[model samples]
Target: MATHHKADQPTLRSLTKRQWIRIASVVAVVGLVVAGGAATRSIYSHANAAPTAEPTAYSISDAHAASRGNARDALEGEPTYVNVTINGKTRTVLGTNFTDVKSVLDAGDITLESGDTVEPSLKTKVDESTTITISRAGAKMETEESKIPFNTVKKETSSLPKGTEKVETEGQEGILEKTNLVERSGDKIISSNTFASWVKKAPVEKVILVGTAEQQPQTTTDTSNNSSSSNSNANNNAQSASNNVGTTAPVGEMQQWAHDYLLANGGTEADFTATVYIISHESGWSVSATNPGSGAYGLPQALPGSKMASHGADWATNYQTQLKWFWDYCKSRYGSVQGAYSFWQANHWY
Candidate 1:
């Protein structure tokens, strides 16, 4: 009977609906307070946080001082590539932060020579990527005088044997020079060339005695005896000396043929040395001198070789024919041996 009374006093199922609403309201209030506190704490934390870092400053200038500092920093900090022109060639290299323009070139293995010039000096610093150019040195020139071989002249006199002559004086020589040699520093023969007829002189011709004449008294008897004796021995002696004189080295048939050819072809002793000089240089008294490089043949080294035949069909063996060709060539080209020799000196060919 007693247990039944206590159950009736505190039974939840028996509690009123208004009482349940009050409990639910209290629980909602507590939850809102806790949530507001959490939101406030998050806002405070965000406001008090530290800020991020900023970027470094960079500058470029033409001035040496600022550019130097900037260039140094750039090189030390990071690798930047730059372009440089050296020795007429373009080169690219990585510029260090502390690297000046000169040092950069050095690192690139660009060395300056005596005549070489660079746009930027060693003290110049580059703040940014840059291009440096180097100009190579040009050729050097030199002048010199050189003695050259000239023509040989021959002369005949009554006091000497037939076909004999002597070189009165040595042939004249001249000088030639070349200019502008291209080479590196301390190099020789950079460029070379011959100067034009700087000076010219007439070459002296050779002379000699060919024969002698005998003078006789005006008496009839003496004159008759002298004339008879002269014919008898002179004829035989002349015949014997003919073969010998023709083959003689300096005063041989060649010299005689040259003399006859020149006199007949409007040439004089004054121009003799000039003519001989050219022929000697070309053929050296050899009828068979031929140019293997250009196919020039004969004493004159005629390009076609057949051109000499125009003087005479016997140009191959007849000195007169060769001399004729030479005379014509001289008149048409140089007017004389001296003129021709002058041209040869400058050009090495005429």
Candidate 2:
């Protein structure tokens, strides 16, 4: 168990220095080959590299301008639609850059004239749901013709007898023109107002004349005589004819005028006394004498007062007209004034 063993070791070789020199030479050669390979791979990688791009330049303003142009183009592509009412006529239109109602109307080629109005002001912004209205409010003068009534007037005159009337002038209607201001909205009527009215033709008034005259009372006289009075009447007629030339009248001024009137009408101076006697009995030379019993009127004591109008309208008031009528009555009834006087002498009235 107690054995001690000697450990020894030692070896010696021949030619060791020459061998080490050879191995070092071979290592150096290998290192050179590896370095050449790495250089070739770096050249290939440099040839395969891609080229870099150049940088572009622009200002903020230019960029903004380009953006706005694009925005406008987009807006033009999509137009806003709106309805327009011009004078109550409605239509639809498409408008680009539609900023206000007026712009939309202008795009639709609508024009606004003077006195034209629009609802939803021209400055109002246009939208899809917006509706524009335009009204033509031109002032126009309208005229119409109308009629005017004439007035009737009356006047009093003494030339005609009482209770008599006559037309002095004819009446004519007049013409009038009335003007109005009319307003219309399209085909519908809105308002009308009268502005001016004037007479086109003046009216003519009707004139009537009325009479006013007084009537007198009538009385009778005695003319009774015998049949031999015919010779006396003839003598009386000759005496009256001779007295007609005298300046101093035997009777009063009215009898003188009656004598002249009868002479002017158709009676001779011989009929003057007989006429005077007949008139003195009938009406006492009263021009307006009226018979109360027989309703006879005037100096002639006509059966009806209106019958005297055949001779003249003034028969009731004119002594000459009554005398002429009396002369004709005597001629027609008794053949002559002398005959009438004789009848009156027998009857008291002829």
Judged by TM-score, which candidate is best? 1
For residues 187-284, what per-residue lDDT tens digits would candidate 2 score against the true structure?
76576544333344544546565655455464464435544785775576445433332121225566778767767878665577576545544444
Model 2: clashing residue pairs?
Answer: 223-345
Give one digit per residue, the lDDT tens place, for model 1 in 121-181: 7778774445676666663334344443443333433334445554445545433222222
Considering every candidate listed, which one attains the maximal lDDT? 2
Runs with alpha carbons beyond 4 Å of true place in candidate 2: 1-250, 264-266
lDDT of 1: 0.48
